[model samples]
Target: MAKKSGNAFDFGLFKRLVGYTNPYRFTFYFVGLAAVLLSIFAVARPYLLQQAIDTGFVPKNENLILEYVVLMLVVLFLEVIFQFLFIYFANWLGQEVIRDIRVKLFDHMMLFKKQYYDQSAVGRLVTRAVSDIETIASIFSEGLFMIFSDLLKMIVILGFMTYKSWQLTLIVLAILPLILYATRVFQKKMKTAFEEVRTQVSNLNSFVQERITGMKIVQLFTREETEYTNFRSINEKHKKGWVKTVWYNSIFFPIAEMSSSVTIGLIVWFGGLRAAEGDVITLGVVIAFIELSQMLFRPLRQIADKFNTLQMGMVAASRVFAILDTDARVENKGTIQLKNISGAIDFDEVRFSYLEGEEVLKGVSFSVNSGDTVAIVGATGAGKSTIINLLNRFYEIDSGTILIDDKDINTIDLKSLRSHIAVVLQDVFLFADTILNNITLNNPDITEQQVTEAAKEIKIHDFIMSLPDGYHYNVKERGAMLSSGQRQLISFLRAYVTNPEILVLDEATSSIDSHSEQLIQDATDKITEGRTSMVIAHRLATIKNADKIIVMDRGLIVEQGTHTELLEIDNGYYKNLYDVQFSTVTE
Candidate 1:
């Protein structure tokens, strides 16, 4: 059983959410004023009817009756106008606030540390940004002003009832305790039910999103029946959550309705008897109190339901605020901007861990001098990718320091640090856009001529020209339209076009055809000519000519030297790896 957010209303949460309305304060106040006017005008109807009956019927004055009817019509017209204003501007205010909140939330998420995402679900974040924020919008359009209007209308009706006849007012007020208790019970029940519904919604979102994203794997492994069963189970729980809310509504609404009906009946019976006995309760008063009883009790019934909506909004608001409150981000406090850097990188006994007490890089030390190409080779999980992630400032080091050209990388501006280094990853991802946009990432500074020149330098210009629309070709999602090797070509061109001082190629040539491999090989050779390059590869043949090689095992560097020099050592780690891999290639 999951915990439900209760206390129905949270004043602190309310105030914080209301702060978003500061920019649209005029609309906020206007809607509030409209609610008040609508409430006053709502009470005007019963009074006008009471006057029309007592003055126009008992006194037989047709002209006054006509005047009261005309006044009623005018008030109705005003109520309609204000109702429209209340609804329109309230929704407008909601949209504006959500727009600002969504943007701010997304901006905050964009800066979250990589480690934060490692443990978070993408679908859950999507819900917060999309549906959950929409729930907060209901706070304005349906919850806040509607509840205020209903409560105000009930108050004004109560005042009129007491003024007309205190006896009838007491009869109506007698049902108050019963209805209030029912509302409380209904509220608690509904709160838990709604929490389950929201939880199931998030679960469904997460399940569906991941399944759809990995549909290929599902089909590859013939998991259609199994996945369908899993989906049905989740869907059933989602249905059960909603049914519980419906069941609660079924019980509560009729009880509320019966309470209202009994109060109205008591008003008619008591006021009629007193009027017949020639007391102060006149026929007009009886009729008016009946209408007033409805106006009062119906809102009491509705206020319960509207408050539920308000509670859900607050629950959603709390979720949204939780994300906004997330402070997991790489702190960028360095004021020193990096420029004209020599691309000299030194890792001074750097220690790091993705999880506490589980060190991935333990006191790893290495150095890459300016204008040199270095290759790092190790089996999987040797902290190879961790090094690149740290260099880009995606994650903070657990201990030790990394220096760039004698200056600490932590002291260099994060944005400027990444700007001067272009990392070409092994898994190339391209957007669903034109080949040109994918290469330049819509950067206005990188023109077609520059891209063409860069493409020609890497010898991929002929390949781009061969495509159906040339550089204007749409690659579809994740470059699904292009082959793996072709996508790598685009990635190389993207990296080279930036012309960064340092290049980190993370096994970019793996898992491709022989022709594509040679083409990428040629592009790789061309790009690393004058740049400080760090090449991570499992294919030892590819990096045999590298100026230096760093061989690592389990989180520690075991060997460092040129390929020939390391191979010359008897029983060395690099020598063993070289012998095994070169034999497999020969076989």
Candidate 2:
């Protein structure tokens, strides 16, 4: 329930959203013209009745009566036609504008860095892209028509009533101030109710998503009853919020209906007396005034109904604007270009913190010579992964610099910098697509031969060919259909296919079976042959053949040497880790 404060609906955002409608402005203009024309034609209908009653019917002029009826029928038909056209265009215009907004919002969301995703919730973001856009879409579709049609008809009827009988018009309009006051009060209450409902919806969505994703864990921990109770709590909150909105609407609509009925009764009674006394009121004028009063109150009923949707639109607009306003924490201002690289990497006084007042890496400095394999080993949260994040520029360093082939990383274009790095993560993420697509990651430009060669080099081609569909086999979400070993193998092939200048193997074989680990080790050796590689290994066996080993503790490099060199030290952390791994293997 974040508050939407000042300048949230500023002109800048409105202007940008409005720019989306520029393509359909001409059609909207036609809708406006039709609205005006329909309003004029509608006003003429009551006048036609008035004229026929006072002149043609009273005198028994058959030809004049028939002529007026024919004219009225034509006007009625024209009004209906133009009304349909107006609605058609307005709906068409609104939908297209909404489509444009959704596409732009999604595109912008994709361009944003991982930091933004970390800070935002999935429920709220989906609500904005979906519910909020629909709210705005309603404004363009039916809301605009009701606002224009009702307001214009009210204006025309009011003007005509004043022209025909000024004294009576004044008497009827005295209750208008009361109508406006009631509308304002109901609108304020309804807005608050709808806002509460929107919050409840987001909460419900979050609970459902969290529970479904972690359902297996809930069952394993015997927390089914607890989770059910929690889910019921969220559901009850949503139901209660909905009931409150219904209660308010139930009361408001009846009040509007009663007030309108009272107004109509007063107009009819007063006008009847005036006509009987032979004053300015005539039979025809009296009838027309009654019709005019109904027209005026019709819009009032509509205005009441539309208040709910208008408030919903405002809330949605606030959400959408918030996302569009997110500032990028990672910026690429570098103009340097490097088409060919030598795979050398250096970290010069690099320091970083995920948040303020808590530093993760302090004065971390290291260099990997061209085509060298370096292992970074430490206990959990020693800033091991943070070092690779800096190398890939996923997150910015708080201070100091990382360099690639002598060029400061911040001085190179970000896309090009990342393009030269290949990352094989331990947690594999495969799309629900063909095995070929999963290996190539839907990158159409990657040739089939390149995919096959990468798979063969990674020692997975033979295994894939044994499967029913081979490369055409479908991988479920997160590679759920494949074994952990198979998923890891595919990830290895994916990484090697890029043939990157630098390789980041982030505990890449941590979860694989022994057989798959050996295959990955072979693939790793081939891929890292001419590339500078940084290995973050929890398994000592994986990095035993590294050219250099750096042992870290509390954000500092406590020891650095070859594995054999580190093993020779009697009390070093690396020696202790190697001894522990050896003990486990022997046991």
Q: Candidate 2 on 40-83: residue-level lDDT in tens? A: 99789999988887788878888888988998999999988998
Candidate 2 global CA lDDT score? 0.80
- lDDT tens digits, residue span 1-587, model 1: 11345555568878999999999999999999999999999889988999899899889999999999999999999999999999999889989989999999999999899999999988988998999899989889888988889988988888888899999999988998898899988888887787778878889999999999899999999999999999999999999999998898999999989998999889888999998998998988999888888888788778887877877787788888988988997898877898888899999999999999999999999999998999998888988888998888899998989988888888888889888999889999999999999989999999999999999999999999999999999999899999998999999999999999999999887767777877888898999989899999766556787999998888999999999999999999888888787547631
Q: Which pairs of residues collide in model 1?
A: none
User: What does the lDDT come to for candidate 1?
Assistant: 0.89
Q: Pick the candidate with the highest lDDT.
A: 1
Q: Identify the leading candidate in terms of TM-score.
A: 1
lDDT of each: 0.89, 0.80
Backbone clashes (count) for model 1? 0
